[model samples]
Structures are given as C-alpha cells and as structure tokens.
Target: MSLAPILLFTYNRPEHTQAVLDSLSKNKEAIDSVLYIFCDGLKENSSEENKSKNKLVQQIISSENRFKEVKITIQTKNKGLARSIIDGLNTVFLEHEKLIVLEDDLILSPFFLAYMNDSLNRYKDFKNVGEIGSCNFFACGKEFPTYFFTNMPDTWGWGTWKDRWNKFNEDAVFLYKELEKNNKMHAFNTYGAYDMEGMLKDQIFGKVDSWAIRWQAVMVLNNWLCLYPNPSYSNHIESINATHAKINMVPPLQNNEPTFETIEIKELKNVTEAMQLGYSGKGDYFGKLSKKYLKKKTKKILKSVLLFPLPYGIVAFFKKNKPKK
Candidate 1:
C-alpha cells in the first residue's frame, strides 16, 4: 500500500524539531514515505533570539534527507500555529488524497506510520470515519479493543483524507451558534467531562486561538467518528514555551504493528466513561471542587475586581494575597 505524506509543522523550537524528526525517521516507512515540513515565519517584533531559533529549525529541516521525498515551505510572514496548520493541510490535500500530521513537539513510535497508513487505507471510503488519531489519552483497561471510535478528534498525531478535511469549518461564530441552537453543547463537551464548549467560546471571543477546537467542533457537528489506537502510536512532549501548558498523561506507545479491521461506527461506553473520568477530575479533590464551583466563583470575583472602582492599594493587596481556596 502507498504511504501517506507526512506533514510536520514547526516554529522556533529547534531542539524539539530535531527530536521529533529523529523519532519519525526511525519509523519503518520513513525511508519511502514523502515528508513535508512547514516552518512558520517569526512574528512581528520578534526578538533576535527567536529569529536565531527559527533559523536553526529551518537549517535542520533543510539538511534532513531521511524521507523518500522532502519538501519544505518556509513562510515569509508569521501565520501563527492555527493558520499554518490550516494552510498546510490545504496545500498538501491539493496533491495527496490523505496525509499524516505532526507538530514539532510530538514523538512517534516505529509502528506509527504503519498504523496510520493502514487505518487511512481501511477507512478512506468510509464517510463516517472522519480521521485516524494516533494518540489515545483515554485510560482504557487491557480488555479494551485495539481500536475504538469517538466523536472527538485528537490533533497530537493524526491523519485524514481530503474529503473529510474539506468539510472542516473554521468559523467559530457559526459553529458556536449551531451547537448552542441545537442544544448539543452537552455532547460536545463529552458529557461535561471536558471544557470543550468553553474552549470554543474562548475561540469565538478571541481569548484563545485554537484550530483543534474548531476541528473538534466540525467532527462533533457532523457526528463523525475518529478512530484511536489503544496503545497510542504517538505521544506529546510538553514544552515550557508551548501554548498548552497543561501536561497530559502520555499513554504507552504501541510496541508492535496493530491489525486494522472495518468496524461499525459507534462510541464505546467504557471508553467514553474512561475519557470522562480522566477529564472530570475524579481522583483529585481540588480538580473536582474547582470545576464544580471554584472556577465560576473566581471568575465573578475577578470581574468585580476589574470593574469596580476600588482603592488602588486595596486592589493591589487583594490581588497579591488572593485566597488559594
């Protein structure tokens, strides 16, 4: 079977870029599979240190020849991570029907490429299968199947066909309105286990710029299922400078090749419950309390502090000694 093209997005993280590249190059299919590197340009007012790092990243990419074909696109202007990914996907879909994607901070197992290619080929024509996710964050028991389906799409390491990606809607306003109007917010949040709805709202309000949230919104709206491997074929590496500061529990990488099978598209209750529990702050006392009450109360207090005309000294003291509860 033909291998799907791999697209790697990078910015100013040279060390991370090199690490991920080395890991991906170890894949059995790396020698024959085509690879594309999209290096985003430095932002406006970027410091010289950042410029140096970006240049180092480009240099590393340019010197790489591990793949059968290596294509590089160094942007002249900053497009941010969101725009860069959207544009990169569009550009690749023009030539290839499907492709795998990875960010600069992800490490892939040797069998990652094999699993992705197999799944892509198996589900290429299945309209219900929107994408193949390589990372499984959900805590599953040993009896859980090798693979399962969910409405949520993971971005850490994933692949999708042009047809499925073509339906991706980036309009945050439209997606929010539709979900709210249809009363699908609960399902969209994975039954209140996650703050996906809040993330979408943040995207709409300009508080955060996230392409993954928008992509998930599309998947949720269309009732599309993303296939996830049990022992995740990929894992994310946390970086101090990364946008997502929350550290995720990386599952053990798949040690051997997994067999792919055509299965009915449906969410597994056990897997769903596991995912909800994982995100619902079950074992942590502070997590449950914060999610259930502290967050809302804190937000209200902050709003009052910002809007109320209070003495400067008093406000400063209040902020300095903010209650930890």
Candidate 2:
C-alpha cells in the first residue's frame, strides 16, 4: 500500500474522541494519510451504558475538519471493544497492508503517524518486528526521542502489518476452553508477573478482556519485537477514564513544552536493541506474578493512604463517563 491506514476505535466518549481527532488534524503531515473510524454500536438496546455510545455517534457526525483522506465504519449493533477491534482490523487489512491503531482516549504528536508508517515500511521485511508502538510509559534514561525492542505492543496507540494481524486468534470466545481444557494457546516468558498467559487468566478467569493483550501473547509465541518511542510518541489522555489502564492518576507525564516528533531512520537501531531486552523469551513466569501482585498491593495502599482525601475514585468514575468527542 502507498500509505498506512489509521484504524480508530470508538465507543461513547465523544469529547475524548473529538480531542483525539483534533490532535490528528493538527499533525504536521495529514493530507497523505487515511483515517478509518470504527464507531461501535450499542451492545443491547436500552442498555444504561448506551448513553455514551449515543453521544459518541453525535461527535463523529459533528466533526467538521476532514483529514487529507478519511473513511468511516459504523456498526449497527454493539460488537464490544474486543470484537469491534478484531473485526474492524480484518476489514482494514483487506485494503491496506499496514495500519496505525488508535483509540478515542489517546492523543498523538504531529509526527506519530509519520513515525509509524516509516517504521512499518522500513521493517516490513523483518519478521522480528511485530508492531510499532508509541505508548512509552517508562523513563528508559535514554537521550533520544524514541527506542524499540520487545514488549507486547499495548494498543494505546500502535501500528502493525496485515500479516501479523492475521496471525492473532480473533475468534477466541472460548479462551478458557483453549487454556485449561484444550490447552492450545501458546505461552511466552516474561520478566514480570504479567505475561500474556496471566493476561488471559485475568480475561477469562479474572473477569477481564482485551484483544491487544491476546495478540501480544501470539506475538510472544512467535518471538517478535515491538518498537517503542523513547520519550513516548503518544500520551494517554484517557488515563483517568480508561478501564484497562493500570495507573489512573493525574498523568505525571502530561505537558506541551517539548515537541513530540519522529527522528531520522538512523535512530531505529537503538530502539530495536532496547526492545529486544525488555522481555524474556519464555514468558518469565515468576517475574510476571511478582509484578502483578506487587503492583496490586501498591495500588491498594496508594488508594487507602497516600491518595485518600482527593476523591480520586469519584473523579476517575466521572472521567470514565465523560464524552469522548
């Protein structure tokens, strides 16, 4: 494909969605891009949560500034996040070889799209690169703007090739069946306690779900690397409202001083090297368990002691209900 398609997943959060779109429109390069919006339908009519979905649809219709090129997909029925994403991706892959995926709550810098497309094109021949990710949450103590290596490409704002997308098991409804009964899903080692397998457990057994983590498991099984920005190419605006986010406080990293932009292709080598060392090949089981348990305990203490007076939980709840447009 001459250009990479951007796959946007949205539900009822029109304000956040609108903010995300605004960020996209202000990008340094917009005319050559294609934005494909996947507006999910309500899961069930008269459902209480459909109020947000209704507003999200209104925002999409109200947006006036058109990108260089844009295509939209509106589902008549609610397919839920996981299904809507897996299905929307399948359709996009039919037309484009590469795609950059974004959600309503994440905002990208002017160079985010450009960086992703260039990386995808540059690494198309390399099977080791499973995806392009801009969600740089950690401070790697590096001097450059970005880095890459390995990690399950979290879907906050990511890009991938059609070939890799096809490899994820989208029809994993009976995930528990495959895990305990049948034992077909592959497991990869992790240096922390939160490997793909535990993610699956959290989904099926722990009352959790997300298509991205499952896809990460598949990438891990295949032993592939996911590139990340050094200073983070994208920032999570939905941190307060995001259900899947582990850290839901006022972002310690939000600001407008340093311009976020992509650097020359010569820098990709450093990114690639760091990513490779980020994960263990065997799904570091003990580390995964340790990280998860420790983080859980820490969050509990933070909520009860350090962050007690602020009504953080209430604020987060309202944010969750806030419009995405």
TM-score, model 2 to reference: 0.70
Give the Å shift of residue 206 in candidate 2.
8.3
Q: In candidate 1, how many Å is residue 279 off?
A: 2.0
Model 1 regions more than 4 Å off: 283-325
Top candidate when judged by TM-score against the true structure: 1
Compose the digit string of candidate 1's lDDT tens values, residues 1-325: 9899999999999999998999999998999999999999989999999999999999999999999999999999999999999999999999999999999988889889989999999998888889999888764447567788987798999999999899999899999988888888888998788899889989999998889999998888888999988788988887777766366545678877577777777998877777676567652211123353557768888988788657975878889999998
* Candidate 2: tens digits of C-alpha lDDT, residues 42-66: 6665566667656656567446346
Q: Poorest 10 consecutive residues of model 2 by lDDT?
A: 280-289
Task: Tell me the lDDT of candidate 2.
Answer: 0.64
Best by lDDT: 1
